[model samples]
Target: MKAKYLVLSFFFFTAGTLFSQNKSVPKSIIKQNASILKFYDKKELQSMQKGQLLVLYVERTKTLIKTLPYIALASKPGVTMVDLGIPFTSENISLLDTQHDATDKFLDITTEFQKGMLPYSDKESLIKAILFYESVLKQMHELNEQE
Candidate 1:
């Protein structure tokens, strides 16, 4: 009878502790989302020249790569790309260094995002492409700043 009471008491204590813990999403995340939506509009992306878009993409990618380690450390445990609304998997994180190296090599030769080397012709597709990197960078910065 005493063991049964103890078990119930422990369970309630754990439940109360978990419930009382702060699990609210940070304010920075809300602000970041707003910033991304405002800045990465599809219409704006559509208006940009391919070369301009490419330069921005490459720059943002490089920034993201540099910021990623701090992001990883500062982020809460079990925070997945899905949690952040980033449409990437853990596997993609492993590939960023390789991608960064290639982009760095390309940038070394020329500062232009060449016309013939366009990643996407469709305006919507281009927005999506740029949106992902920009979103990650913005969100990570917000998260890091909060900590």
Candidate 2:
């Protein structure tokens, strides 16, 4: 009987904790839906004020983060395609090298995107392309925020 009572109390304690947590959201904020979120509309310069905006952005961007890994095409194995012969066997390459190439590709592709350098059916090419831009934004934000 005592063991049963203890178990029930523990369960209630855990349930209470979970309910309190769900009720009080410090980090996550919920918001209404947006009509459109396009390539150009992606730029959000305004400071976030409303809980709803935070929710929308978080949900949308969580989707984006989930999509990011899928967005990146596996780098083709070659010296010529990468063009610099940067030997990366995915073991010992430095991040600085990767950043340089990614940044260059970003600038190159932004021009290409405007001029239609790449064909249409590249399979999430645009998302991966924008990843570079987003990466830069994240880095800048982190740097400013001392992250």
What's each prediction's TM-score? 0.41, 0.22
Note the residue pairs that clash in candidate 2.
31-52
- Listed per candidate, the RMSD to the true structure in angstroms reads 16.3, 18.7
Predicted candidate 2 versus true structure: per-residue lDDT over 47-137, tens digit per residue: 3333433334333343333223321221111122133443443332334336445644654555455345334324244434444445543
Alpha carbon deviation, residue 137, candidate 1 (Å)? 1.3
lDDT of 1 by residue, 83-126 (tens): 56654544554454355456458645553543445555665656
- Candidate 2 weakest lDDT stretch, 10 residues: 26-35
Off by over 4 Å in 1: 1-39, 73-122, 145-147
CA lDDT, every model vs. true structure: 0.55, 0.38
lDDT of 1: 0.55
By lDDT, the best candidate is 1
